[model samples]
Target chain A: MIWVAAALLFWGMAWALNAWLARSRHSGLRAVRIAVPVIFGLTILVVWELLVRGLNVPLVILPPPTMIAATFGGNLAILWEDFVQTFLKGALSGYLIGCGAAVALAILIDRSPFLQKGLLPVGNFIAALPIIGTAPILVMWFGFDWQSKAAVVVVMVFFPMLVNTVQGLAASSAMQRDLMATYSASYWQTLLKLRLPAAMPFIFNGLKIASTLALIGAIVAEFFGSPVRGMGFRISTSVGQLALDMVWAEITVAALAGTLFYGTVALVERGVTFWHPSQRK
Target chain B: MNRILPILSVVTAIIAFWYAAVVPMNIHGVLDQAERDGVVVVPGTAKARRDFASLGLVMLNPGQAAKSWMQERPRLPAPHQVAIELWQTTVEKKVTSKRSLVFHAWVTLSATLLGFAIGTGLGVLLAVGIVHNKAMDMSVMPWAIASQTIPILAIAPMVIVVLNSIGIQGLVPKAIISAYLSFFPVVVGMVAGLRSPDAMQLDLLKTYHASRAATFWKLRLPASMPYLFTSLKVGIAASLVGAIVGELPTGAVRGLGARLLTGSYYGQTVQIWSALMMAAICAAVLVGLIGLAQRLILQRMGMTGR
Candidate 1:
């Protein structure tokens, strides 16, 4: 089938391009590395369009890539609404609350050994609780609006952020703390000048991780219960109606949102943690 | 100041807080669960405890004064109640009662174990291919990551319907979905693990005239064990997720996933929560078991955690 041939061709081109990019010591390898996936993806889409049309495969089993693009273009309104409801209403709120609360709590725990011992394991236990199980309970407790989705996101984002912040709080060398002590820096002053800055890289690691988790938590929570407007809601219901086009469109939206979310966090990370060794060129 | 008391007391206080908070959350669905199921029992004790918590504010101060008191304030069946329910469901039932949580959990466990095996095998194979060939590495890695970006919930129903339409009904469809969801982590982890052996190590092997296969088996594969086990821990959890996700669309006869859905539909919040607890426990136990295996296997290989 032309579809199979196109897929192979596209995949082969991607591989070849990637290998060339990796091996080449040329100045513009960065541009080439980025370009390879783009070119390969476009080629696949073109081949997919050709193959599906050539084979006359049923549109249901495998819609042409062009058709999927058309659907994505046509359904911008619903897609935007789903985006607002999920990303803006649920995920963003939860990520802010969960990550903010974690940093604050990490500071508190850092201040007291007692709090450190008691709280860390509890955070671990909560993190270990599967979202699939907790999502429904949260929906029941918080009601089936964006509130439940936000609650699930909170639970999902909380522990990773906490653990990371805790680790980051410890990131400063003891010698550095000793220098501050010799300088007679106050508790808050020492925290502000040294430890908090030192923790940025670890904090950003948690942020990057939680960005994906927040999106996932919001989406999965919608599956358990929702008010018919979320991306998760649309995807789940559309599939039941066997509307693959709409489903793929919603997926495209989710993919875009997830990528953007992660990218933004990574960008912030690069900015905030520029002094960290990992950021060094 | 630098002692365990702070940690112990803090945790104890939190537990006290959770107990206090949940006491009022009225999970009485637990405490009243026995009576509601028409099992022979004392009903008044649970109701009395609820009443005591609400009306017995006086009793609390007195208990605080006296150190302890009687008529243990009724909880949502307490830990003991849930344990009793677990027993009634798992060990006590003549096996396969509709009321049995174990029956539903078993339905899920079978699919989880099967899917995990298939998924892990597929992941390891793909990892091998990717590690060996530069071409496969670039081509496959991106697709694998992109595949995960599409939420599994969106894909689960399509998998169920498509597989059914193609005359592949029943467990195979669900297992395929699980396998599809699970293999990527293994591939990712294994790739990193296999490459962890350095150029110097590879050069040493080459100097000894080690064949490609010998070097792979002795150096690459063994070096990959830590990464493989870490991925397996993640893969096992992901497979369980796949199994649970698989249940949603297929209209399966049983599984913890099914119980959650049905319980939600029927307003059986307690049942849903109980099933979720069971699933969490299963995941924890399985991940722990993998961790144990990692320890034993790595020790045998003379590799410590470092």
Candidate 2:
């Protein structure tokens, strides 16, 4: 009861502080802007920890955040192995191959208006469909290994990357192309000097989207079938054992890997497309 | 009309490719069956045949390759076989029958629709709160964006299990997942939409002495329609996927996802293919309906450029 009361009091104080900080004249400062959310997140975690302990929620149903953290800390080696199997081997390799193929194909099809018109709508339609259904079939074909997970990730990322790269290739204005023509720049030269640079933003958008899909595809494919190691394998198995703490641990790894992967892509985008309006600031 | 021919040709090319790939993918199994039936195959031993690539095996047993398309559990079911299975399960079986694809689709669809409604409602309310309150905008907005980068779907199984232990079962568990998956996109899109009114527009409202609620109803809400519909399309698709994935962890026996799981377990390639086709059709139809609604609403609002 005391713990619950303390948690409630802390929540009120934290929210009030946030509300005050948000209206403060210094709120525009970068430090204050970052601090507000950080404080809010910490508040939630603290409240969650207190409430679970105070209410005596069962560990199987919901582990406290501190216990989850302890589990995560205790299982570092196992978590690392699963992370390497799922993210580094399965997702990353598939992301490279799939996105590479899509960009190459996009450039090839850029020369033909007929192919573009035909493929764009088809790509869009397929992208919206539940392409994840292919996970089972691919798992069967590739065997219960990282290779199968990679294959699923490949199929998942391919169409979106293709569509984005194709759209990006068309992003440059006729005026820019005409200027290149007036300078007598060859097709390859013009592509390198102008269109590709203009396409970087769109390409990065595709990359960011594909990065998330790759992690998801690799993890979910393992749900269909996988070897003894991998995040999905651990998650499903742990759930069966009612070891909710371990499941939370695996989820923490997935969340970290996903955020880092996406953040890296966005960072690269900012560096590459600094001149683009969205990145100019 | 100008676009029709290219699209048709593209579709034809894909189907043709799928048929051609089926031969190689299933050739080894086909040859094994043929050899068992007393028909001689080149490099006749199964071990010798296993050493060769699938394409080579197909070449060595062209006559046997035709059998691949008709195999009970081909590595890849031929397109027509999938289409036939889809037709049979959907049309031939009664809707109430356990074998019926319609029954499975309905189970999944109901959960999806329920989740989408809950997610969209909560998302809109949150978006409104964020727009109206500086504290929420500052504190919650970044987390909402960051939450999307996390693979929240990975927790579907845990969510299902946790809810089950609490005596919350059936449609609600699946709908909870669907709602969680769909929630972020709506919040993000709605926030952008509600804030879309430019300085000039807001000034106009202010000059008219509009109350905050009146300003929101007339300006912000209407301005958010196009953005709302766009995210709704994305949200609904995500919701459907969530429901399917939620079905997976529970080993639920009644959804399309269960059909896929059981088929995979039993090596019923035909059944898996049909369930996949059904899922694809459901996704297309749901998205199309949302699109239709978007068109109608936007047109009624006089927001469409045309």
Candidate 3:
């Protein structure tokens, strides 16, 4: 009861503080902007910890964040293995291959307006479909290993990457192309100098999207079948064993890995597309 | 009409490619079966044949290669085989039958629709709160954006199992997963939508002495329609995927995910292919319906471009 009251008081205080900070002139400062959300998140975690302890919620149902942290700390090696199998060996390899192929195909088809028109809609349609359904088929074909997970990631990322690259290649305006023509620039020169650089923003946008999809595809494909070492395998098995702490630990690894992966891609995008309007500010 | 020819040609080319690739994909198995039937197989030994490329096997036994498409469980089922299976399960079986793809699809669709509605409602409400309250905008918006980077689907099995242990079974658990999956996109989109009314438009409302409610109803909601529809399309597709994946940990009991699982377990590649086709069709139709709704609502409000 004391814990609950203390939690409630803390939550109320944090809410008031955030509200005050948001309305204050200093809220425009980067520090205040960052602090508000951090405070908010901490408040939730505090409240969750207190409430679960005060109410005596079963560990099997919802393990406390502290317990999850402990489990995460204790099982670093296992988590790292899962991470490499799913994220590095499966998702990363597939992301590179899929995006590379899409960019290559986009460039190859850029010369033909007819092919572009034909393929764009098809790619868009495929992108919106539940392509994850192919996971089981791919798993069967590639066997229950990291290879199958990689294959799933490849198919999942391919269409989105293709569509984005194709759009990116067309980002250069007609006037820019005409200027290249006036300079007697060969198609290859113009493509290399003007078009590919212009396409960086769009390509990066696709990469960022595919980064998320790659993680998701690799993990979900493991649900269909895996070699007993991937994140999905651990998650499903832990749940059945009612090892909610282990499940949460794996989830923590996944969340951290996903955020880092996406952040890396965005950071690279910032460097590569520094002159793009969206990146400039 | 001009675009139609290109699209048709592209589709035809894909189907042709799929058909051509099936023989090579399934040839090793096809040749193994032919050799079991005492047919002469090139390279003479199964051991030698195993090391040879699948395309070489296809070339060595052209007569047996056609049997790849007719195999009971080919590695890659032919497109027409999938189409036929889809037709048989959807059209031939009774809708109430467990074997019916229509029944399975309905099981999945209900959860998707229910979750979509809940998610869209919650997302809109949260967006409104974020937009109106400076505290929420500062505190919640960043986390909401960051949450999208996390693969939330990783928790689907855990969610289902936990909910089941708590005595909440069937569609609600699945719907909850779907809701969680679809929630972020709608929130982000709707936030952008509600704030889309330019400063000039807000100033006009202020000058007219419009109340906050009046301004919201008359201006903000209308401006948000385009963004709302775009997110809804994305949200619905996500919801459907969530529902299907949610079915997986339920142990091959029902839904499209079950079909995929059971097919894989039994090595029924044809069944898996048909389920995939059904899922694709469902996604297309759901997205198309949202698009149609967008057109109708936007047109009725005179929001369409002249």
Which tens-of-lDDT digit does each residue in A116-141 have in candidate 1? 76677666655655655677778877
Question: Per-residue CA lDDT of candidate 1, range B84-189, in tens?
Answer: 5566766777657877778887777787788888988989998898888754565567767655444554567677776676688767777777777678878888
Model 1 misplaced stretches (Cα beyond 4 Å): A1-28, A43-56, B1-15, B27-81, B142-153
What is the Å distance of residue B165 in model 1 from its true position? 3.6
Docking class of 1: acceptable
- Candidate 1 has a DockQ of 0.42
Query: Which prediction has more favorable DockQ, 1 or 2?
Result: 2
TM-score leaderboard ranking = 2, 3, 1
Error of 2 at A102 (Å): 0.8
Q: Identify the candidate with maximal DockQ.
A: 3
DockQ order, best first, reads 3, 2, 1
Interface RMSD of 1: 3.6
Give the DockQ (2 decimals) of all models: 0.42, 0.83, 0.88
lDDT string, candidate 2, B1-306, tens digits: 789888888899999999999999888888889989999999888999889999888777777877888998898999999999999999999999999999999999999999999999999999999999999999999999998888889999999999999899999999999999889999999999999999999999999999999999999999999999999999999999899889898789999889989989999999998999999999999999999999998899999921
Per-residue lDDT value at A106 in model 1? 96
